[model samples]
Target: MPASRPNLRTIAEHLGLSVTTVSRALKDGPEVKPGTVAKVKAAAEQIGYQPDARGVMLRTGKTMQVCSILYSPEVGDYGDPGFLAQVESLAQGLEADRYSLVVLAQTSNKDPLEPVIRVHTQRMADAVVFSRTTSQDSRAKYCLQHDFPFVSFGRTELLTPHAFVDHDDEQAAYDAVKRLIADGHRKIGMIDPPENLTFFGYRKQGARRAMTEAGLDPESLIWMRSDVSVRAARDATTALFRTQRDATAIVCASQMTMIGALEALMELNMDTIRDGIGVVGFGGMPFRMLSKQKLAYYYQPQRHVGEVLARHLHDLMVGVPAQELQTLLPYRRIDDLAAFREGEDF
Candidate 1:
C-alpha cells in the first residue's frame, strides 16, 4: 500500500487523547473544552481527515440518497421538457431536505423497471422516484410489493396505497376543449398520445366530456393518436386534415404535437387556418415563441409539480402517512388572445 488515508483514530493516537474525546472535539461537542475542540479541528484540517460516508450510513441506516429513474425514449422521439423540469425541481426540493438526488437513465431499454430494479438491488440509493406511469406500472408495483419507500410522478391504477404527484390531465383537456367550443368551433379535432398511456385516457375522457357538454356529437369529432414525436404528430395532423375536411379546431397533447400540426398545415397550404382555427396545446407555452402560429395552450407548472413530488418522497421516507403523500397540481389555460400578449412565452 502506498500510504493509508488519515482517520479519527490516527488523529487521536497522534494527539495522545481518547477516541471519544477526539470525536467529541472534532464535532465541537459541548463536553469538549474549547481549546481542545480548536486543536482537533486544526489537526483534522492538517491531516485531510474526512468522515467516512459508508460508516455513517451503516451507523444511522440512512444513505441520504434519493434516486429517480428516467426512461430515454426511442431514437427520434422528442423528450418532454416538462418532465425534465420536474426532475430539476425534485432535485432542488430534495436538496432542502439534505438529500442528494441520483438520476439513473434507462436508454434503449424496453423494460421501464430495469434501472429502478438495478438501483434498488445494488443498494445504490435509499429511496426511489419514478415518472411516466402506465395503466399498470411495473416499477410502482415492484416498489409497492417490496414495501420500499418510493413516490411516482404520475398515478397508476394498481390499487396500491403508494404516494404520487400528478396533474389533472382530464381537467386540462376539458378546459382546452371548452375553450375551442367557446370560439364557436363546432367540428373540433384532437391530436393526442397513444391510448395505452393512463394520462392519454384521462385527456381523451376530458375531451369527450367537453364535446358532450357542448351538445356536440363526441363520436363525430375527429381524433388521432401520435407518439411523443413531432413527425408522428405531423403525420397524424395531415391524416386528420385529409380525412376530416370540416375540422375547425384541434386540441394537441403537447407543444411538439402543436408544432407538428403547424408543420402539416403549412405543407398543406393551410397556413391561413390559424386566423380561424381554434387550436389548443398542452404543456409549457415557451415553444410558442419558436413558432409563428398563435395557438391556445396550457401552462403546466412542471417545476412546482416536481418540487411537490420530491417533498412528498422525503415525507414518505420519513414515515409520513400514505394518504397524505398524494398531491394533484392544477394547470392554467392560455387562450389565443392571452398567448400573444404574454411578452415571454416561457
Candidate 2:
C-alpha cells in the first residue's frame, strides 16, 4: 500500500542511517548514539516525517507514537469542545519530531480501560494520553502497574504517581460558588456532571466547602446531574426549580450544563437578569454566543493543554519522572464583561 506520509524507512534512507538506528533515535531508545538523535529529528522536520510507529515496532519493538483515548469532541457531548482542539494541537506540537498522535475513540458506555488496554496489549503506540478520569481510575492504575508511559487529563489516586495535566476544578468551583454567595444569592443550585468522574467530585467538594464557609447548609443547595445537553439540563433545572422557585443563583459544572440551564430558565419564562438569577459555570465561547446576557464562567487554555500534553508525553517516553510531569492548569474566571472587563486568574 502507498504510504499516507513519510515513514521510518524513508527517514532512515534520507539520513543514510539504518532503520534500527533511526527507530532508536526517533524514540530516544537504546543504541541511539550521541548527536544522532538530533540529526534524525532534524531530518524528520526538514523532510516532514509522519511516523509509522507500528511499522517501527514490527522490526525494533520501539515506537514514537502517542495515542489519545478520546470521545467525539462534538457539542453537548461532555460539555467540552476542547477535546478536538487538544488532538489537533497535540498533532501540531508533535510535528516538531517524528512523533505522531493517534486518536482512539472511547464511548461513554464502554469500560474506561478498554482503549488503554488495547494500547497495552497490542503495543501499537509508545505512550498514551486520556481524559475523563476517575478517582482510582482503572486506566491509570493499569498503566502504572504495567510500567507504561501515559498522561491523564485529570488526577487519579494511586500508590504510584503518573504524569497528568488537569484543571483545578475544585478551586474553580469554590470560587464560582463563593462569588454567587458574595452577590447575595442565598437559595443556590448546582448542575453537576456525572458523579463517577473525579472532577465531578472536585467541583462538588468546592461548592460544598464554599457553602459551608458561608454558614449555609450545603445540603440545602439544589444538586442535579445531567449530560450537558440542553434537554437533560432543562429537565434537571426544571426539577430543581420545582423545589425552589426562589433560587437566586446556580453553579453549573460544565459548559453544556450552563447552556442547558439557560434553556430551561427561558422555557420557564425566566431571564437570568430579569429573574435576578446569577449563573456561573465552566466554558467560554458558547456562553457568549448563546446567552443574551453576559455570563461569568471558568475558561481554560485548552490549546495550551494540547501543547503541554504532547510535551509531557514526549518527556515521559524519554525518561522524565512521572511525578515531575504532573501539572494543574488553572482555570481563568471570565466575569461579565460589563461588570468586570478582564479574566481573573482562579
Candidate 3:
C-alpha cells in the first residue's frame, strides 16, 4: 500500500537514526537525550512527519487507539443531535495525546458490548470507552475478567474494580424537578428514557424524591417512558396529554424529547406555560441556545467527559491504578439566558 501519511520510519531514515530513537524522541521518553529529541522533532517538522498509527501499535503492543461504540452519530439515533459533536470532542481529546479514536457503529440493539469484545480479543485497540451503562453491565464484567484497559461514561452496579467518569445526573434531575415544583405545578409528569439504563434510574429517583419532599404522590403523576428518539418522545407526549389533561408540568429526559414535546403541544394548540404548563429537560451542549419561555434545561459536561475519559484511559494503559480511574464531574444548569448573562460558568 502507498504511504498515506509520513511515518516514523520515513523520519528515521531521513535523520539517519534508528526508528526506536525516533519513536522515543517523538514521545519525549525520559531516557532519550534532549539534543537528540530536539533534532528528531525539528527534522520531523521539516519533513511533515505524521506518525503512522498502525506502526506505533505494532511496535509497543499499544495502539494508542481508544474505541467507543455508540449509535451512528450521522443518523442522530440517540435523539440528541449533539451526538456527532460528542464524538468529535472525544476524537479531539484522544488526538491531543497523539492517540486515535475509533468510533464503531452500534446498528443493532442486540448487545452493545459485542463490538467492544471483538475489538479487545482481536487486539485492534488499546483501550475501550463506552457509555449508557446499565445496573449490572456485562461489558464491564467482561473487561474486568479479561483485564483490559477500559473506562465507562457512567457507573455500573458491579462491585469489581473499574474506571468510570459520569455526570451528576441525579442531582441535575433533582434541580429540574425542584424548579417545576416552585412554579406551583401540582400534577407533574415526566418523559423518561428506558428504565434499564443506569442514568434513567438516577433521574427517576430524583424526580420521585422531589415529589415526595413536596408532599405529592409520585404514583399519581404521569410517567411516559420511551426510547431515545424524538418521534418516540413526541408520541409519548401526545399520549400523556390525552390521558392526564391536568398535568401542568412535564420533564423530558433529553433535549430532543423536549423539542418533541413542545411540537406536540403546539400541534394540540395547547398554550405552553400560559396554560400553567412548563417543560424541562437535559442537553449535552449549547443548552442556553435551546432555552425559551417555559422551557428550562441543563447542559452536561460532555466535552469535559470526553477529555477526562481520554486522559483516564491513557492512565490505565500506562499502568495507573484502577481505583484512580473513576470520576463524577459536575454539570451546569442552563435555565435561560439569565444563567449565561449573569456570568454563570457553562
Q: Best candidate per TM-score, number?
A: 3
Residues 126-224, candidate 1, lDDT per residue (tens digit)? 899877788898988888888778888778898767898887899988888887788788888788776777888888889889989988888876778
Candidate 1 wrongly placed segments (more than 4 Å):
1-51, 74-77, 272-275, 290-292, 336-346
RMSD of each: 4.7, 4.3, 3.0
What TM-score, over all chains together, does every model reach? Answer: 0.81, 0.83, 0.89
**lDDT (C-alpha) at residue 19 in model 3:** 96
lDDT of 1 at 243: 84
TM-score-wise, the better of 1 and 3 is 3
Candidate lDDT scores, in order, read: 0.78, 0.79, 0.79
Query: Cα lDDT of model 2 overall?
Result: 0.79
Candidate 3 lDDT over 1-346, as tens digits, reads 8755778888889889999999899889988999999999999889888766676777777777788877653246545666667677788887767788887777645588798789898887878888778989988988988888889888998988789988787888788887788888888778877788898888878888888888888777677887767788789888888888787888888778877788788877786656767888777756543434567777775676777877887788778998888898766666564565566677
**Candidate 2, run of 10 with poorest lDDT:** 337-346
Best to worst by lDDT, what's the order? 2, 3, 1
Task: Please give the lDDT score at residue 17 for candidate 2.
Answer: 90
Error of 1 at 94 (Å): 1.2
The candidate, 1 or 2, that scores higher on TM-score is 2
Q: What is the lDDT of residue 185 in candidate 2?
A: 91
